[model samples]
Target: MRLRLVALAALLSPLAACSTVSEAVKGPELAPVGYPAALVPRDQSVLPLASAREPLPQAASANSLWRTGARAFFNDQRASRIGDILTVQIDIDDSAKTTNATTATRTSGMTAGVPHLLGLESSLGKILPGGFDPANAIETNSSTNNAGSGQVNRSEKISLTIAAVVTSILPNGNMVIQGTQEVRTNAELRQLTVAGIVRPEDISSANTIRHTQIAEARINYGGRGDISRVQKTPAGQSLIERFSPF
Candidate 1:
Protein backbone atom coordinates (compact mmCIF):
# COMPACT_ATOMS: atom_id res chain seq x y z
CA MET A 1 0.00 0.00 0.00
CA ARG A 2 2.83 2.41 0.70
CA LEU A 3 4.41 1.73 -2.70
CA ARG A 4 1.10 2.62 -4.51
CA LEU A 5 0.84 5.92 -2.62
CA VAL A 6 4.43 6.89 -3.61
CA ALA A 7 3.72 6.11 -7.29
CA LEU A 8 0.60 8.37 -7.27
CA ALA A 9 2.63 11.31 -5.84
CA ALA A 10 5.33 10.96 -8.50
CA LEU A 11 2.73 11.05 -11.29
CA LEU A 12 1.09 14.24 -9.99
CA SER A 13 4.42 16.11 -9.70
CA PRO A 14 4.99 16.16 -13.49
CA LEU A 15 1.40 17.43 -14.08
CA ALA A 16 1.96 20.35 -11.75
CA ALA A 17 5.25 21.22 -13.45
CA CYS A 18 3.54 21.28 -16.86
CA SER A 19 0.87 23.68 -15.61
CA THR A 20 3.45 26.07 -14.26
CA VAL A 21 5.42 26.06 -17.53
CA SER A 22 2.27 26.77 -19.54
CA GLU A 23 1.44 29.78 -17.40
CA ALA A 24 4.91 31.28 -17.78
CA VAL A 25 4.88 30.94 -21.60
CA LYS A 26 1.37 32.30 -22.06
CA GLY A 27 0.99 35.53 -24.13
CA PRO A 28 -0.29 38.68 -22.46
CA GLU A 29 -4.06 38.81 -22.11
CA LEU A 30 -5.78 40.21 -25.22
CA ALA A 31 -7.29 43.68 -24.81
CA PRO A 32 -10.35 43.65 -22.59
CA VAL A 33 -13.25 41.45 -23.81
CA GLY A 34 -15.58 44.27 -24.84
CA TYR A 35 -15.56 47.74 -26.35
CA PRO A 36 -12.13 49.36 -26.48
CA ALA A 37 -11.31 51.74 -23.65
CA ALA A 38 -10.57 54.46 -26.22
CA LEU A 39 -14.31 54.74 -26.88
CA VAL A 40 -14.81 56.16 -23.40
CA PRO A 41 -14.52 59.89 -22.85
CA ARG A 42 -11.00 60.99 -21.95
CA ASP A 43 -10.27 62.54 -18.56
CA GLN A 44 -11.10 66.24 -18.70
CA SER A 45 -7.97 67.09 -16.78
CA VAL A 46 -5.78 65.95 -19.66
CA LEU A 47 -7.42 68.19 -22.23
CA PRO A 48 -6.27 71.78 -22.56
CA LEU A 49 -8.65 74.61 -21.55
CA ALA A 50 -8.94 78.20 -22.70
CA SER A 51 -7.63 80.90 -20.45
CA ALA A 52 -10.10 83.31 -18.80
CA ARG A 53 -10.57 86.47 -20.86
CA GLU A 54 -13.18 89.21 -21.22
CA PRO A 55 -15.79 88.44 -23.86
CA LEU A 56 -15.85 90.54 -27.04
CA PRO A 57 -18.83 92.90 -27.45
CA GLN A 58 -21.42 92.23 -30.13
CA ALA A 59 -22.16 94.55 -33.07
CA ALA A 60 -24.03 97.76 -32.15
CA SER A 61 -26.59 97.29 -34.95
CA ALA A 62 -28.67 94.11 -34.53
CA ASN A 63 -29.85 94.16 -38.18
CA SER A 64 -26.49 94.97 -39.73
CA LEU A 65 -25.27 92.57 -42.47
CA TRP A 66 -21.73 92.71 -41.04
CA ARG A 67 -20.84 92.40 -37.37
CA THR A 68 -17.80 94.14 -35.84
CA GLY A 69 -14.73 91.88 -35.61
CA ALA A 70 -16.66 89.09 -37.39
CA ARG A 71 -15.85 87.47 -40.71
CA ALA A 72 -17.57 89.13 -43.66
CA PHE A 73 -19.22 85.90 -44.78
CA PHE A 74 -22.04 84.62 -42.59
CA ASN A 75 -21.35 80.96 -43.57
CA ASP A 76 -17.65 80.88 -42.66
CA GLN A 77 -16.60 77.28 -42.03
CA ARG A 78 -13.25 77.83 -40.29
CA ALA A 79 -12.63 76.16 -36.89
CA SER A 80 -12.17 78.74 -34.11
CA ARG A 81 -14.17 77.72 -31.04
CA ILE A 82 -13.54 74.94 -28.54
CA GLY A 83 -15.29 71.69 -29.55
CA ASP A 84 -15.41 72.76 -33.22
CA ILE A 85 -14.26 70.00 -35.60
CA LEU A 86 -12.18 70.41 -38.77
CA THR A 87 -10.32 68.22 -41.24
CA VAL A 88 -6.54 68.05 -41.50
CA GLN A 89 -4.92 67.03 -44.79
CA ILE A 90 -1.68 65.20 -44.24
CA ASP A 91 0.89 65.19 -47.08
CA ILE A 92 4.39 64.18 -46.21
CA ASP A 93 7.22 63.49 -48.65
CA ASP A 94 10.77 63.32 -47.39
CA SER A 95 14.09 62.20 -48.83
CA ALA A 96 17.64 62.39 -47.54
CA LYS A 97 21.09 61.30 -48.71
CA THR A 98 24.47 61.62 -47.02
CA THR A 99 28.06 60.51 -47.75
CA ASN A 100 31.21 60.76 -45.65
CA ALA A 101 34.84 59.83 -46.34
CA THR A 102 38.03 60.06 -44.27
CA THR A 103 41.64 59.34 -45.14
CA ALA A 104 44.87 59.45 -43.05
CA THR A 105 48.53 58.62 -43.68
CA ARG A 106 51.72 58.85 -41.56
CA THR A 107 55.43 57.98 -41.95
CA SER A 108 58.30 58.22 -39.44
CA GLY A 109 61.97 57.24 -39.20
CA MET A 110 64.53 57.39 -36.28
CA THR A 111 68.26 56.74 -35.99
CA ALA A 112 71.06 57.13 -33.37
CA GLY A 113 74.89 57.25 -33.68
CA VAL A 114 78.05 57.99 -31.60
CA PRO A 115 80.97 58.99 -33.87
CA HIS A 116 84.18 60.31 -32.36
CA LEU A 117 82.61 60.94 -28.94
CA LEU A 118 85.57 61.38 -26.60
CA GLY A 119 87.67 59.62 -29.23
CA LEU A 120 85.47 56.48 -28.77
CA GLU A 121 85.29 55.88 -32.58
CA SER A 122 88.83 54.44 -32.55
CA SER A 123 88.02 52.08 -29.62
CA LEU A 124 84.53 51.28 -30.94
CA GLY A 125 85.97 48.63 -33.28
CA LYS A 126 87.47 46.84 -30.27
CA ILE A 127 84.27 46.94 -28.11
CA LEU A 128 81.69 46.50 -30.96
CA PRO A 129 81.46 43.52 -33.38
CA GLY A 130 82.95 43.86 -36.88
CA GLY A 131 80.75 45.39 -39.65
CA PHE A 132 78.39 46.85 -36.96
CA ASP A 133 77.58 50.46 -37.97
CA PRO A 134 76.96 52.78 -34.94
CA ALA A 135 75.25 55.31 -37.20
CA ASN A 136 72.51 52.71 -37.96
CA ALA A 137 71.93 51.84 -34.30
CA ILE A 138 68.26 52.22 -33.16
CA GLU A 139 67.13 53.00 -36.75
CA THR A 140 63.39 52.55 -37.39
CA ASN A 141 60.80 53.32 -40.12
CA SER A 142 56.94 53.15 -39.88
CA SER A 143 53.95 54.04 -42.12
CA THR A 144 50.18 53.93 -41.53
CA ASN A 145 47.17 54.54 -43.83
CA ASN A 146 43.40 54.49 -43.08
CA ALA A 147 40.26 55.18 -45.14
CA GLY A 148 36.52 55.01 -44.30
CA SER A 149 33.29 55.83 -46.08
CA GLY A 150 29.59 55.84 -45.14
CA GLN A 151 26.39 56.53 -47.06
CA VAL A 152 22.70 56.75 -46.13
CA ASN A 153 19.52 57.07 -48.22
CA ARG A 154 15.95 57.23 -47.03
CA SER A 155 12.49 58.25 -48.27
CA GLU A 156 9.05 58.30 -46.71
CA LYS A 157 5.59 59.47 -47.76
CA ILE A 158 2.16 59.53 -46.17
CA SER A 159 -1.09 61.05 -47.48
CA LEU A 160 -4.36 61.02 -45.60
CA THR A 161 -7.01 63.17 -43.96
CA ILE A 162 -8.33 63.08 -40.43
CA ALA A 163 -10.79 65.15 -38.42
CA ALA A 164 -9.63 67.16 -35.39
CA VAL A 165 -11.37 69.10 -32.65
CA VAL A 166 -10.35 72.40 -31.14
CA THR A 167 -9.48 71.71 -27.51
CA SER A 168 -8.49 75.19 -26.31
CA ILE A 169 -8.13 78.83 -27.33
CA LEU A 170 -5.02 80.74 -26.41
CA PRO A 171 -5.16 84.31 -25.19
CA ASN A 172 -4.01 85.43 -28.65
CA GLY A 173 -6.84 83.49 -30.35
CA ASN A 174 -4.73 80.53 -31.53
CA MET A 175 -6.46 77.14 -31.22
CA VAL A 176 -5.10 73.91 -29.73
CA ILE A 177 -6.31 70.75 -31.51
CA GLN A 178 -6.38 67.03 -30.79
CA GLY A 179 -7.80 64.16 -32.80
CA THR A 180 -7.84 60.33 -32.73
CA GLN A 181 -9.34 57.81 -35.11
CA GLU A 182 -9.41 54.01 -34.95
CA VAL A 183 -10.48 51.42 -37.48
CA ARG A 184 -10.91 47.75 -36.65
CA THR A 185 -10.86 45.17 -39.42
CA ASN A 186 -10.70 41.39 -38.89
CA ALA A 187 -9.58 41.66 -35.29
CA GLU A 188 -6.93 44.28 -36.07
CA LEU A 189 -7.17 47.84 -34.81
CA ARG A 190 -5.46 50.62 -36.78
CA GLN A 191 -5.12 53.97 -35.04
CA LEU A 192 -4.16 57.48 -36.10
CA THR A 193 -3.58 60.47 -33.82
CA VAL A 194 -2.94 64.14 -34.51
CA ALA A 195 -2.43 67.09 -32.18
CA GLY A 196 -1.16 70.60 -32.69
CA ILE A 197 -1.75 74.32 -32.48
CA VAL A 198 -3.14 76.37 -35.39
CA ARG A 199 -4.10 79.93 -36.12
CA PRO A 200 -7.76 80.46 -36.96
CA GLU A 201 -6.73 82.13 -40.22
CA ASP A 202 -4.97 78.97 -41.41
CA ILE A 203 -8.25 77.10 -41.76
CA SER A 204 -9.53 77.24 -45.33
CA SER A 205 -13.07 78.11 -46.34
CA ALA A 206 -13.80 74.35 -46.61
CA ASN A 207 -12.89 73.88 -42.95
CA THR A 208 -9.65 72.05 -43.83
CA ILE A 209 -5.99 72.81 -43.22
CA ARG A 210 -2.81 71.12 -44.37
CA HIS A 211 -0.56 69.44 -41.81
CA THR A 212 2.21 71.95 -42.50
CA GLN A 213 -0.07 74.76 -41.34
CA ILE A 214 -0.07 73.35 -37.78
CA ALA A 215 2.46 74.40 -35.19
CA GLU A 216 3.99 71.95 -32.73
CA ALA A 217 2.29 69.12 -34.61
CA ARG A 218 2.51 65.48 -33.64
CA ILE A 219 1.25 62.63 -35.79
CA ASN A 220 1.19 58.85 -35.24
CA TYR A 221 -0.09 55.95 -37.36
CA GLY A 222 0.08 52.27 -36.42
CA GLY A 223 -1.92 49.12 -35.79
CA ARG A 224 -2.08 46.06 -33.51
CA GLY A 225 -3.46 42.56 -34.06
CA ASP A 226 -2.44 39.00 -34.97
CA ILE A 227 -0.55 40.35 -37.98
CA SER A 228 1.34 42.77 -35.80
CA ARG A 229 2.24 40.02 -33.37
CA VAL A 230 3.44 37.71 -36.12
CA GLN A 231 5.77 40.45 -37.32
CA LYS A 232 7.30 40.93 -33.87
CA THR A 233 9.89 38.73 -32.12
CA PRO A 234 8.74 36.53 -29.26
CA ALA A 235 8.86 38.18 -25.84
CA GLY A 236 11.10 35.51 -24.33
CA GLN A 237 13.51 35.60 -27.24
CA SER A 238 13.55 39.41 -27.20
CA LEU A 239 14.33 39.45 -23.48
CA ILE A 240 17.21 37.02 -23.97
CA GLU A 241 18.58 39.07 -26.86
CA ARG A 242 18.50 42.25 -24.78
CA PHE A 243 20.72 40.71 -22.08
CA SER A 244 22.99 38.82 -24.48
CA PRO A 245 26.56 40.03 -25.02
CA PHE A 246 26.60 39.32 -28.72
Candidate 2:
Protein backbone atom coordinates (compact mmCIF):
# COMPACT_ATOMS: atom_id res chain seq x y z
CA MET A 1 0.00 0.00 0.00
CA ARG A 2 1.10 3.57 -0.55
CA LEU A 3 2.69 5.03 2.55
CA ARG A 4 0.46 8.00 3.05
CA LEU A 5 2.57 10.90 4.20
CA VAL A 6 0.38 13.67 5.65
CA ALA A 7 -3.42 13.41 5.45
CA LEU A 8 -3.67 15.22 2.12
CA ALA A 9 -0.59 14.84 -0.12
CA ALA A 10 -1.17 11.37 -1.67
CA LEU A 11 -4.67 12.31 -2.80
CA LEU A 12 -4.49 15.80 -4.25
CA SER A 13 -2.84 16.91 -7.49
CA PRO A 14 -0.97 20.15 -8.07
CA LEU A 15 -3.04 23.33 -8.29
CA ALA A 16 -2.44 25.89 -10.99
CA ALA A 17 -2.09 29.30 -9.37
CA CYS A 18 -2.70 32.47 -11.34
CA SER A 19 -3.05 36.24 -11.00
CA THR A 20 -0.80 37.59 -8.27
CA VAL A 21 0.00 41.20 -7.54
CA SER A 22 3.61 42.23 -7.93
CA GLU A 23 5.14 42.25 -4.45
CA ALA A 24 8.40 43.91 -5.49
CA VAL A 25 8.83 47.35 -7.02
CA LYS A 26 9.37 48.07 -10.73
CA GLY A 27 10.89 45.26 -12.81
CA PRO A 28 13.85 45.57 -15.12
CA GLU A 29 13.56 42.73 -17.67
CA LEU A 30 10.95 40.07 -18.33
CA ALA A 31 11.98 36.46 -17.85
CA PRO A 32 12.02 33.94 -20.70
CA VAL A 33 8.76 32.15 -21.34
CA GLY A 34 8.22 29.31 -23.89
CA TYR A 35 9.50 25.82 -24.51
CA PRO A 36 13.16 25.60 -23.59
CA ALA A 37 15.56 22.95 -24.82
CA ALA A 38 15.24 21.33 -21.42
CA LEU A 39 11.81 19.91 -22.27
CA VAL A 40 10.21 18.49 -25.41
CA PRO A 41 6.81 20.15 -25.79
CA ARG A 42 5.68 17.80 -28.48
CA ASP A 43 2.32 16.44 -29.67
CA GLN A 44 2.36 14.11 -26.69
CA SER A 45 4.63 13.08 -23.82
CA VAL A 46 6.29 9.96 -25.20
CA LEU A 47 6.93 7.12 -22.72
CA PRO A 48 7.74 3.86 -24.55
CA LEU A 49 9.02 1.10 -22.28
CA ALA A 50 10.25 -2.44 -22.83
CA SER A 51 9.17 -4.53 -19.78
CA ALA A 52 8.46 -4.46 -16.06
CA ARG A 53 10.70 -5.69 -13.25
CA GLU A 54 10.36 -9.13 -11.76
CA PRO A 55 7.49 -9.32 -9.29
CA LEU A 56 8.44 -9.17 -5.64
CA PRO A 57 8.50 -12.82 -4.67
CA GLN A 58 9.11 -11.52 -1.17
CA ALA A 59 5.80 -9.66 -1.32
CA ALA A 60 3.05 -11.13 0.79
CA SER A 61 0.04 -12.52 -1.05
CA ALA A 62 -2.21 -9.44 -0.52
CA ASN A 63 -3.70 -7.21 2.09
CA SER A 64 -6.27 -4.45 2.53
CA LEU A 65 -5.05 -0.91 2.93
CA TRP A 66 -5.95 2.79 2.92
CA ARG A 67 -4.28 6.09 2.08
CA THR A 68 -3.61 9.12 4.26
CA GLY A 69 -2.88 12.73 3.50
CA ALA A 70 0.52 14.46 3.19
CA ARG A 71 2.04 17.91 3.73
CA ALA A 72 3.97 18.19 0.48
CA PHE A 73 3.94 21.63 -1.13
CA PHE A 74 6.31 21.68 -4.11
CA ASN A 75 5.82 18.67 -6.39
CA ASP A 76 5.17 17.57 -10.00
CA GLN A 77 3.46 14.84 -12.10
CA ARG A 78 4.45 13.79 -15.62
CA ALA A 79 3.28 11.17 -18.14
CA SER A 80 6.11 8.66 -18.56
CA ARG A 81 7.06 5.39 -20.25
CA ILE A 82 9.85 2.83 -20.74
CA GLY A 83 12.07 5.02 -22.90
CA ASP A 84 12.16 8.66 -23.85
CA ILE A 85 14.94 11.23 -24.16
CA LEU A 86 14.69 14.19 -21.80
CA THR A 87 16.19 17.57 -20.94
CA VAL A 88 16.02 19.63 -17.75
CA GLN A 89 16.13 23.22 -16.52
CA ILE A 90 16.55 24.75 -13.10
CA ASP A 91 15.70 28.13 -11.63
CA ILE A 92 16.15 29.78 -8.26
CA ASP A 93 15.35 33.06 -6.59
CA ASP A 94 18.16 33.69 -4.10
CA SER A 95 15.97 35.86 -1.87
CA ALA A 96 13.51 33.35 -0.45
CA LYS A 97 13.97 32.36 3.17
CA THR A 98 11.90 30.91 5.96
CA THR A 99 12.03 29.71 9.55
CA ASN A 100 13.23 26.21 10.26
CA ALA A 101 11.36 23.46 12.10
CA THR A 102 12.12 25.88 14.91
CA THR A 103 13.16 29.51 14.99
CA ALA A 104 15.59 28.35 17.64
CA THR A 105 17.05 26.17 14.87
CA ARG A 106 16.24 27.53 11.42
CA THR A 107 16.20 24.71 8.89
CA SER A 108 17.59 25.13 5.39
CA GLY A 109 16.57 28.00 3.13
CA MET A 110 12.80 28.28 2.84
CA THR A 111 12.74 28.54 -0.94
CA ALA A 112 16.03 27.02 -2.00
CA GLY A 113 15.96 23.95 -4.28
CA VAL A 114 12.37 24.29 -5.31
CA PRO A 115 11.81 21.52 -7.85
CA HIS A 116 10.62 21.38 -11.48
CA LEU A 117 11.20 17.68 -12.01
CA LEU A 118 10.35 15.71 -15.17
CA GLY A 119 10.76 12.03 -14.42
CA LEU A 120 9.14 8.56 -14.53
CA GLU A 121 9.04 6.20 -11.57
CA SER A 122 7.97 2.57 -11.52
CA SER A 123 4.31 1.91 -10.84
CA LEU A 124 5.10 -1.06 -8.65
CA GLY A 125 1.94 -3.11 -8.47
CA LYS A 126 0.20 -6.29 -9.69
CA ILE A 127 -1.08 -6.18 -13.24
CA LEU A 128 -4.80 -6.94 -13.06
CA PRO A 129 -5.37 -5.83 -16.68
CA GLY A 130 -8.55 -3.95 -15.78
CA GLY A 131 -6.51 -0.93 -14.76
CA PHE A 132 -5.11 -1.69 -11.27
CA ASP A 133 -5.99 -1.69 -7.62
CA PRO A 134 -4.05 1.25 -6.22
CA ALA A 135 -4.99 0.22 -2.71
CA ASN A 136 -3.79 -3.37 -3.00
CA ALA A 137 -0.94 -2.67 -5.43
CA ILE A 138 1.41 -0.73 -3.23
CA GLU A 139 4.87 0.37 -4.13
CA THR A 140 7.64 -1.54 -2.40
CA ASN A 141 8.68 -0.08 0.89
CA SER A 142 11.28 2.62 0.32
CA SER A 143 13.92 3.01 2.98
CA THR A 144 14.87 6.40 4.39
CA ASN A 145 16.62 8.46 1.71
CA ASN A 146 19.60 10.07 3.55
CA ALA A 147 19.98 13.17 1.68
CA GLY A 148 21.53 17.16 0.84
CA SER A 149 23.39 20.14 0.94
CA GLY A 150 24.35 23.22 2.96
CA GLN A 151 22.25 24.94 0.30
CA VAL A 152 19.27 24.33 2.56
CA ASN A 153 20.95 27.02 4.66
CA ARG A 154 20.91 29.73 2.00
CA SER A 155 18.26 32.45 2.20
CA GLU A 156 16.76 31.89 -1.24
CA LYS A 157 14.18 30.18 -3.45
CA ILE A 158 15.06 27.79 -6.28
CA SER A 159 13.75 25.17 -8.70
CA LEU A 160 15.47 22.34 -10.57
CA THR A 161 14.37 19.95 -13.30
CA ILE A 162 15.36 16.48 -14.63
CA ALA A 163 14.38 14.48 -17.73
CA ALA A 164 14.18 10.71 -18.04
CA VAL A 165 12.70 7.72 -19.89
CA VAL A 166 11.39 4.23 -19.11
CA THR A 167 13.82 1.36 -19.61
CA SER A 168 11.76 -1.72 -18.76
CA ILE A 169 9.02 -3.05 -16.52
CA LEU A 170 9.59 -5.63 -13.84
CA PRO A 171 7.40 -8.62 -13.00
CA ASN A 172 6.30 -6.87 -9.85
CA GLY A 173 4.87 -4.17 -12.13
CA ASN A 174 7.60 -1.68 -11.33
CA MET A 175 8.22 0.46 -14.40
CA VAL A 176 11.96 0.88 -14.90
CA ILE A 177 12.04 4.29 -16.49
CA GLN A 178 15.31 5.92 -17.49
CA GLY A 179 15.71 9.58 -16.79
CA THR A 180 17.98 12.01 -14.95
CA GLN A 181 16.49 12.40 -11.50
CA GLU A 182 17.26 14.77 -8.64
CA VAL A 183 18.17 11.91 -6.21
CA ARG A 184 16.90 10.18 -3.11
CA THR A 185 18.79 10.44 0.20
CA ASN A 186 19.00 8.78 3.54
CA ALA A 187 16.96 10.52 6.17
CA GLU A 188 19.38 9.79 9.03
CA LEU A 189 22.59 11.18 7.55
CA ARG A 190 21.15 13.91 5.32
CA GLN A 191 23.48 12.82 2.51
CA LEU A 192 22.76 12.81 -1.20
CA THR A 193 21.11 9.55 -2.28
CA VAL A 194 19.08 9.48 -5.49
CA ALA A 195 20.20 10.48 -9.02
CA GLY A 196 21.91 13.86 -8.75
CA ILE A 197 25.45 14.48 -7.58
CA VAL A 198 25.67 13.12 -4.03
CA ARG A 199 26.36 9.40 -4.07
CA PRO A 200 24.47 7.09 -1.69
CA GLU A 201 27.66 6.44 0.26
CA ASP A 202 28.19 10.20 0.50
CA ILE A 203 25.16 10.39 2.69
CA SER A 204 25.98 6.91 3.90
CA SER A 205 29.36 8.57 4.46
CA ALA A 206 30.76 8.96 7.94
CA ASN A 207 31.01 12.75 7.62
CA THR A 208 27.32 13.39 7.01
CA ILE A 209 25.66 16.66 7.85
CA ARG A 210 23.87 14.94 10.70
CA HIS A 211 26.84 12.64 11.32
CA THR A 212 25.14 9.28 11.80
CA GLN A 213 25.05 5.81 10.29
CA ILE A 214 22.41 5.26 7.59
CA ALA A 215 21.38 2.17 9.56
CA GLU A 216 20.91 3.87 12.91
CA ALA A 217 18.95 7.14 12.87
CA ARG A 218 16.93 9.29 10.43
CA ILE A 219 17.49 12.70 8.82
CA ASN A 220 14.74 14.84 7.27
CA TYR A 221 16.92 16.13 4.50
CA GLY A 222 15.62 17.65 1.18
CA GLY A 223 16.66 18.81 -2.30
CA ARG A 224 17.51 15.90 -4.59
CA GLY A 225 18.94 13.95 -1.70
CA ASP A 226 21.50 16.47 -0.38
CA ILE A 227 23.20 18.17 -3.27
CA SER A 228 22.80 21.91 -2.63
CA ARG A 229 23.04 22.72 -6.32
CA VAL A 230 19.89 24.76 -6.83
CA GLN A 231 20.07 27.41 -9.55
CA LYS A 232 19.46 31.10 -8.90
CA THR A 233 15.95 32.29 -9.81
CA PRO A 234 15.19 35.40 -11.77
CA ALA A 235 14.00 38.47 -9.88
CA GLY A 236 10.20 38.88 -9.57
CA GLN A 237 9.66 35.27 -10.55
CA SER A 238 7.43 32.71 -8.88
CA LEU A 239 8.89 29.99 -6.68
CA ILE A 240 8.03 27.21 -9.18
CA GLU A 241 9.22 28.02 -12.65
CA ARG A 242 6.94 25.67 -14.64
CA PHE A 243 5.85 22.03 -14.85
CA SER A 244 3.59 19.49 -16.61
CA PRO A 245 1.62 16.41 -15.59
CA PHE A 246 2.67 14.51 -18.71
Question: How well does candidate 2 score on lDDT at residue 100?
Answer: 34
lDDT of 1 at 22: 32
Q: Please, what is the whole-model Cα lDDT of each candidate in the order they appear?
A: 0.70, 0.30
In terms of lDDT, model 1 sits at: 0.70
Across 33-82, the per-residue lDDT of candidate 2 in tens digits comes to: 22223554332222333222222222222452221111122211221223
lDDT value for candidate 2? 0.30
Local accuracy of candidate 1 as per-residue lDDT tens digits, 1-246: 999999777755555434333333443322211212275443223224343232323346587776433455563445667778999999989999999999999999988876657877767778888876666656889999999999999998989899999777765566778898999999899888888878776787678889998876888777889998787778687544443333
Each prediction's total of clashing residue pairs, residues at least 3 apart in sequence or on different chains, is: 0, 56
